[model samples]
Target: MAETGEGSRPGYSSAVELRGVGHGKREHAAASPPPPATDAAVLHSSVLDTIGEEITGDALPEGHVLTLEQIRERFGVSRTVARETMRILESMGLVRSRRRVGITVQPRASWNVYDPRVIWWRLSGPGRNAQLRSLTELRIAVEPLAAGAAARSASAAERERAVGIAATLRALGEAGDLDRFLEADIAFHTLLLQASGNEMFGALADVVAVVLQGRTQLGLMPHHPEPAALDLHEAVADAVAGGRPRDAETGMRELLAEVRHAMLPLWEPRTRKG
Candidate 1:
């Protein structure tokens, strides 16, 4: 995994900060409290997010052992906070805790990759390029199928909304309004997945949304999205509106193909000095 550097997102570079989101949603861990309600809760969230990112970013590599006392000292938190942080990480499979052996960082394979915080950490850190590639590939596989399904079964209102979002995407992309463009882009995918009428596909809406926002936050998105890609967004939406499953599927695949073309180089292996 690559370590975050100058081009990294805001909270990612700081090593200890909360990451707000682009999509009006707060991407906190499932185990976390709602909005860090209390002072102690804020402390716990801060500690958990910081240590979680360190482990995800490979700063704390596999087999790195840590003690509750060490965490308490390093983060200036109470032993209660330190213990809870490690306990959450252990439950997420990012670490293992033993009575006397201490908390040990586990390998990537041991991580609960589906956890949204893990996904956010990986995408925001040096592992960004890799996570984007993996997530994009997943989008390529799932979104097309979702588009086709939506074409077949989407409610009349959903079909109309898809068209409107697609129109918004094109306008924002052309006008260089990336912020609005990103929101519209999120709407485009979110609507398609939910409208797909498949529970499994609908469940992945967050995963897709995270990667979309991550791309922009990481500086991978261009000043303006390519015109061809914008056209395909419309194509998929129109296909869904027209009730053409095959067209929706094909259009989505072609759209994602352009995404892969634009993003592939970011994930290519590069020589790094230790």
Candidate 2:
């Protein structure tokens, strides 16, 4: 989200305003109808991003109240923009509203943890290391199983696509093309999940994409992916293409184990001295 003007509400300085519980009310003429479509789209995206960051960052902790009036006044946005922002957050399981209780941030357990945006926000905040560990553990559990399923069920085209993307990922990684490597890596894993022929596994593509991108963006990835890691990815693709379920599963386990090992230091607790 682009950085923009400061909030209009007193004691709130963020581009998107978030008022505390005890802030006093200000009576003003109702906000003008929202701006043009392009401007409105920008407003919506900005507000949604800011509010989402707050919730996932725990700045607006669970049970914090976010009233419609507070949103409108603090952000200097029309009621429509404010309501739409709230709707987006609600759909993502971040906040909920009631007649008298207002809009309250929901607990983390209630969130749509698999949603890419939610994953990004969480990774951007204080919980990043923990989130990374959790996501990697999840990938370790599921991706190997998905690889085996893909070996049995994937169509010819799906297998071909997976192999092709894996090749591209290996090339990009070896060349130290971080951005393109991240893209191909996402495509490779996503294809594996979709080819598994299990709806639940297919739906996890976004979650995997988020983790891959998050690792690179946060500078956690090595300058070039390890050669063995690239080789394991190719092995997974070849195994799935050849309908070798056991080999596919084994290749994925080894790849994820390498990843987990690389990430372990980040996940360890740090000590401070006086």
Over 105-138, each residue of candidate 2 has an lDDT whose tens digit, in order, gives: 9988799987766776666666777788888999
Residue 140 lDDT in candidate 1: 93
In candidate 1 the C-alpha lDDT for residue 75 amounts to 95
Best by TM-score: 1
Residue clash pairs of candidate 1: none
CA displacement after TM-score superposition, residue 1 of candidate 1 (Å) = 11
* Candidates' C-alpha lDDT: 0.78, 0.76
Where model 1 places Cα greater than 4 Å from the true spot, the runs are 1-40, 270-274
TM-score of candidate 2 to 2 decimals = 0.77
Measured on C-alpha atoms, candidate 1 has an lDDT of: 0.78
Write model 1 residue lDDT over 1-274, tens digit each, in one string: 3444323222222211122221124433322223334333567777887888899886998999999999999999889889888988999999999988999999788899877678878876775777788889999999999999999999898898888888988888999999778767877887798889998887677787767766777777999888888989999999999999999999999988888877777777741223
Residue 58, model 1: lDDT of 68
